[model samples]
Target: MTARPPTVRERRLAGELRRLRESTTALNLEEAAEGLGWSKTKLSRIENAIRKVTAAEVQQMLALYSVTGPRLDALVRFSRTTRQRGWWDVYENSLPTDYATYMGLEAESEWLNSYTMGLVHGLMQTEDYTHHVARSILMRFSPASEVERRVAARMARQRAWTERADPTRLWTILDETALQRVIGGPEVMRAQCRRIIELTEQPNVMFQIMPLAAGGHPGVVGSFAILGFPERFTPNVVYVENMTSALYVEDEREVHTYALAFEQMAAMALSPEESVAMLERLARQ
Candidate 1:
């Protein structure tokens, strides 16, 4: 069987464990494996997050590395926390593996910054718009049942919009053409625009339109989202989607590139208040 890709938690745990082992001058992978009585391959898998490391295993390794006191307790807690499932786990089999991981990260994120050149962002799409868009894109090859399942899963991912007491702060910059494109006919498009208008009133949401008149922009190539977690230690990630797959950029340098691009787009886009006025005007038309 193929090994499952590590979840976000597993990756984080793996990074910390690897850091701990490397920080010790006396320990090397071969020496550590011998001391733990595990093969180098097994130890490598744990460090790379190809396999889930148990709490017991974490304690054993940390102890071997001479980690103790509150630091040891914290690592042990992280091991257990990594095993806890989030709401996104239910749809793991239904969604593409990469998309499922995106949803998982989105769910855990405290803030999101997104830019889109076409279609409304999924987090802000209406049910009618979502259903129509999903059918249009997938109906040719996907079964109706499967398409519906996909649509449902997409809707569920929007929970961050309202479910949390302190809702996830979302800042999105949309290409003006996205507002002009009619995805599900006039009525559906009208409702969709209105939905976004309503969302603008929310304290945690901000939307801006990069008008066509503004001419070419960095976001012209495609769209991406930069997700920030509440935990200070977890660095931000940039997510870029393509036809059938997505790329998650975790390296500080690459994510910085996307971040700068988004800032440029935001600067070129109309202000939030002006964008709302534009949305309302378009909805009326």
Candidate 2:
């Protein structure tokens, strides 16, 4: 069985535990491990979110760190939730580790800002478009079943925007080239355009088109997304993907840079109204 990747909540809990220990106690790693009566490696794994920390373990760590009051109560409560399984966990065997990690974060994000240069954003893709794109990108001679699994996983990821009561707010700036490219031929592309326009009608969805005429821009570097969580302790994450791997940017400075680039791209892109108009035209053509 594959080891589960750390969820956003778990990562946040781990960070808080480390912070409390460092700020409240004079003990170093070795001393803290001795105080807690555990090996240094155990404490180290907990702090790094490499191992799940039980509620009892959390309480022990908090006690050693001298944490008390409402903060203590909240951390204890949060720790219990760290081990809950996500819907995407079932597909872990098929999905890349980093992609699975991104899905976990996406599920918890309150909002997402994405810029796409090559294809439609996964959350906004049509099933047929996804089928074609998946087949094209998967390794040659890959079985049909593998391609179908990927399509299903991508579709499942869309439910966060469609079925959730408080759907995640999405602000995506799609490059005009994505629309111009004939992914699954004319009919499929038309349906894909219509799908984007339909999704934009939802109150929480925002779509803009970065026109080819806009020429070179900051997003010209590559495609990326920034995800913001509801909890203040959970910092924003910037996700960048290439052919084989993905990068998650959590540093405050680096996340800020991606945020700024997204803002600039949004500014240069067509307004929501205009983007919809363009989509309408393409859907008709």
TM per prediction: 0.85, 0.88
Error of 1 at 157 (Å): 1.5
Taking all chains together, the TM-score of candidate 2 against the true structure is 0.88
lDDT of each: 0.85, 0.88
| Candidate 1 Cα outliers beyond 4 Å, as residue runs | 1-7, 15-38, 56-76
lDDT (0-100) at residue 277 of candidate 2? Answer: 98
The residue-level lDDT of candidate 2 at 210 comes to 99
The per-prediction tally of clashing pairs is 0, 0
For model 2, residues 1-285, the per-residue Cα lDDT tens digits are 126667757777887787677778888888999999999999999998888899999999989988888777878888888877788777767988788778888888899999999999999999999999999999656999989999999999997558998989999999999988899799999999999999999999999999999999999989999999876556688899999999878777889999989888999999999999999999999
